[model samples]
Target: AREVGMPLKMARAVQVGGPAWHWANFAKVARNFEWEKKVGNSVVVREAVGVVGCITPWNFPLSQITLKIAPAMAAGCTVVLKPSEIAPVNAMILAEIIHDAGVPAGVFNLVNGTGPVVGEVLGTHPQVDMVSFTGSTGAGKRVSELASQSVKRVTLELGGKSASVILDDANFEAAVKGTVSACMLNSGQTCSAHTRMLVPASRYEEVRALAQAAVARFSIGPSLDEASKLGPLVSAAQRDRVLNFIRIGIAEGADVIAGGPDTPATGKGYFVQPTVLGIKASDTLAQEEIFGPVLVVIPYRDEEDAVTIANNTIYGLGGAVWSASDEHAVKVARRIRTGQIDINGGPFNGSAPFGGYKQSGNGRENGIYGFEEFLEFKAMQFKPSAG
Candidate 1:
């Protein structure tokens, strides 16, 4: 908990993949196979792609590695795992568990080093058939470029500047609270955090007040504390980066309704106060990914304006739509151009394909879609019997 500032209960519940769920996902790969009955005497089959290079990020270290390694191994592809050095202890422990599980030695391997050395080699290696990477957009682009040299398949789960659109007819209190939670979860280090919130222009002050109050309710303290709803960021650099964004948000003329650029009184870890800012829809604070406990509220003129503001970013990762009617929320969600949008605080489903559009990178993860990333297709032809 101290190392990464994640609350113990939350970390324990989510960070490590439980035995049954992990095995269940492995079993899912078996179901990925299909028998095709074509008009002619031909059959199509899916086969293991080949060796896979899995580069996972520091956030949710064990889960990210498991998401890649389990599916790849299940698909029959050998894996070379490279976990972020920032939070690699759990990854090392996971490797021990996999080893104890009796996976063949050559089937799985772990390499510990920086992105420039080990990561670059993995991406460019001709023998590596595919690379599944999760990290920053810049790093993902570099991986794509390097992997392109060998024409290897690449799947990237990159950064996101997601939005949470609050419709005029939605329950104001519930929507605001839900959006605040979505924004500040994991101290806003999440790639899919709803950092931007869109509300009707006429109700801007009302929404802002609710959002500010919700942010205030968040208890910021040491991660080990059961009362703490928010914790310090990952590293000194990340803390500095988030603080810089707060400064920029202020310079951009956004009103800091709650929290500020000042450091938390603890003066201990990389703690940033839970921040909420009210800004113009087109402001820089509304566009950039701060990767902190900073939420930007942007008021829209109407439903059309809300959708327009939601899709105005270069990123199209995750978002949410809140409305009194489910049909109306779904309709607005369909137009938002994001990869995934939660409707009225819908719970996240692990089986669903999770990914993004545009600069958020390509390809999906989770369930069968994730497993297929390690597989290739083949077709067999047979002559029709002559009677």
Candidate 2:
């Protein structure tokens, strides 16, 4: 709560959004399912044994935690939550909220420790029926492997190296600003952030200028600052990781058109300015997910090249396509290999399914799609007796 400067009430609201939203939508789904149910000759469905192990990440700490916790509880499953050790304070607050919400004791449990110690234990625990993890692909793979030993179901939301394609016919100003803002959001810590921008060669210089201006305008300061648009990376290690990418970008001969490899001496905390890199499609900067306020601008010859460059990444999480005409933008978006594609300046709706293809990991989260992750389906058939 203190880290983001959110009030106790607002923090609670944010943490509880997942559960509240899930149940609200779940009720609608349940009602609809009931309407479809015929009262005769159907095998009765019975509730099974229920227990869930939820492992959440540091970014969007409370939100992710609640997403798993709330749905599990709503589905009649007891939960044991192991929040990221990097942001334990927020998790502690969440535990308090769960306790105050009058939830049962064994229904909700919060354990605080690093991934190796606590996370590993939870994943391998025989008592945990399922494991829900949100983190890097590497860690998620380990979680899946360990949980598989017990034949426990696993749901993972992992990393992304998303792309943003700005069509030749798109408004350069709007496209540039949108891409920059997307990368700057949450200091670019978001898994689905459009960090790689593909712009047409004709408007390359123009787009670069607009991106530089957008980066320059970003306010990087203490997390508590109301006016600060870009806060520090989650920790010192995260800050270093982002800085290393910046270093690699410079070393790989990409143009650092805007912010570069320097932390402000005035600030004692972990902070990095929003950086914009003008690079070729082949550059390393264009291929990696910095997960910071870092943007890679790659110029493409045409629509085909743009799509090629965008899909070159192993990650296919989320992306955006901008064009003068909605029809044109949708055409480009359809070709890109991503789970979610935004047209124009479309807002991110939590109601939609969020996940990825390829190495970005499997399965979806959010909306009815996410809820189905907990469900198991079976079809039964019977033949009428011949008398």
Candidate 3:
């Protein structure tokens, strides 16, 4: 819990509802699937991939584990899960729950250790049929490489440096405020957070001012504080990492519009100020994932320029577009190369396929698409019956 800074409400919702949602999705998909189907004179069948390795991240620990475990089990595949060592408490509770619920022995195994040890073993084990991972892009590449040796199917949910494009006609106040919240969510550690806010060059000053004001209003306190709008990062190392990025941004000629690399006076937890930087689209600050409560504002000349700036990153996990007209926002969203785009602050659909394109990693998760990751297909030839 100290690692991810998950608020009570967020943690409770995931603990209470995440499993139900996963199970319901699995049941619904299982019922709808054609278990045995005929194609001409042949039969096509779907079967469970034998063993699945579920490597979950510290952020949203319980839900990430459940999302991978539930679907794999529902598809009749046994699992070996490696929860992040930084926050393994909740996963332990989950394991107890599984035992209490009477899941078959050896069906679900839990291993506690560092990623380099336990995680690497799972990735390279010949007995493991598939591996599903969520973490940094560099680590995901390592996992993919290890799993490749075993010829195991691998699915990765990696890092992102997503952009939020505020069209020239968008509501400046709403877009700026919304983008700030999106960037600051989970203390800006969320992989899909829209850390780069792209605004029209004509309104860059206006948007930057509004964003600074909005960020100024955010309350920073302990994660458990009822009034805290922002919390400390996962660890001291993470705190230093983010601070280094902020320092790098300033060194690269970007202006710190709000917040800075200054450490909070608390001197206990790993806290960082909510920082915003005014930078060019090509600046290092605009292209990299800080993975903290640090946002970069970029100016675009036109709609085409906005799309170009948004798609310039190697990571394309998530993004958003805002405009008065839904059609216009979607037009701009479609031009951006990302796995998912939120138009005008659309509500998140839990059932939608979630993953990414480019270096953001491969394969899909959530809904029916995620469940199918633990399955394989077979076709059998048969003679046609004659009357």
Candidate 4:
């Protein structure tokens, strides 16, 4: 809690206990997969992709590291990790744990530095067989370009400007409240957070009011304070980046219904107010990943417009759709070009696939799909002995 203002309760969950749980899950899944198969006169087999370069983001520092490292190790691939400089302590602690657990020294290595200096090497290194990265879209693009030089396998889970679609027939209050809560989770630092909200135009006024109410309920304070519901951004630069996005929204004539582009009263830390903006799909706020407790509610004329708005972003990471019927919501969800979408505020499923589409980045993470990213396939052919 003290190191970076991670919520007191969530600090343990995110840094310590959560990583532990995920590591065990990764181990379990790793052991259960079939390594080889026989077809006709041939046997096909899976092998480690050799050395893997893992570049993780700071938002869910430990958890993201665990996601990349666990599966890479499970696939029998050696790893070289470069954690975000902003929250590198967790990676150090995790290294200690790995050392204590007696993992071979060469199997895993940690290098700490800025993305430009260290990340570039990981992406371009010829010895590294694969690279898995999680961060901004711009950075991911650079990673891809560098990795392409060596023809290395690359999997990226990058930025998102996901939307929360509330159908006219859905539970309006529940959906609005849930969307606001999700947008503010981790103080909105999450890459997959639903930062945009799409609702029927007829209910714009109602949604505005509901969104305002929900924003008011969030209490910002020092992370250790029991009453605090939100905390500071990871660094001052990040805080300024989010505030700049909010300012752009204002200049673009978007409605600031909840919070504004002002620094919070808690002057010491990088705190942005839990804000909600009413805007059109073309507004900057509706398209960018502000990475703060900010939400943009863009009204849609109908179901078609809602789907159109949801798919308008350069990102296609995560999203949500709410409807009276589960089938209706699922139907709408299928049309949205996102990696994952919540139905009626469904909970995050670690066991399911996660990642993105389009500029949000390529490849899936989590579950068996993530484990497969670090493996290569080979086939051996032989004639049958018996005629």
For each candidate, the alpha-carbon lDDT, in order, equals: 0.87, 0.79, 0.87, 0.90
Q: Could you tell me which 10 consecutive residues in candidate 1 have the lowest summed lDDT?
A: 30-39
Assess every candidate by TM-score: 0.96, 0.91, 0.96, 0.98
lDDT for position 364 in model 3: 82
Give lDDT: candidate 3, residue 205.
81
For model 1, the superposed segments whose C-alpha errors exceed 4 Å read 17-23, 29-39
lDDT at residue 97 of model 4 (Cα atoms): 88
Rank order (by TM-score, best first): 4, 1, 3, 2
TM-score of 3: 0.96
Residue-by-residue lDDT tens digits, candidate 1, 169-256: 9999999999999999889988999999888889988987898889888888888888888888999999999999889889989888
lDDT of 3 by residue, 1-387 (tens): 355775555545644476667767777887787778889888998899989999998877777887799888888899999999998988898899899999999999999999999999999998999999999999999999999898999999999999999998899899999999989987898999999999988887898789889998888887776677787788888889999999999998988889999887755678899999999887888878899999999998988888989999999999999999999999888889999899998866778888999999998888788888888999999877886
Off by over 4 Å in 3: 1-3, 14-20
Instruction: Look at candidate 1 and tell me the lDDT of residue 258.
Output: 93
- Model 2 alpha-carbon miss at residue 340, Å: 0.8
Cα deviation at 84, candidate 2, in Å, is 0.4
- List clashing residue pairs in candidate 1: none
How do all the candidates rank in terms of lDDT, highest first? 4, 3, 1, 2
Model 1 gets an lDDT of 0.87
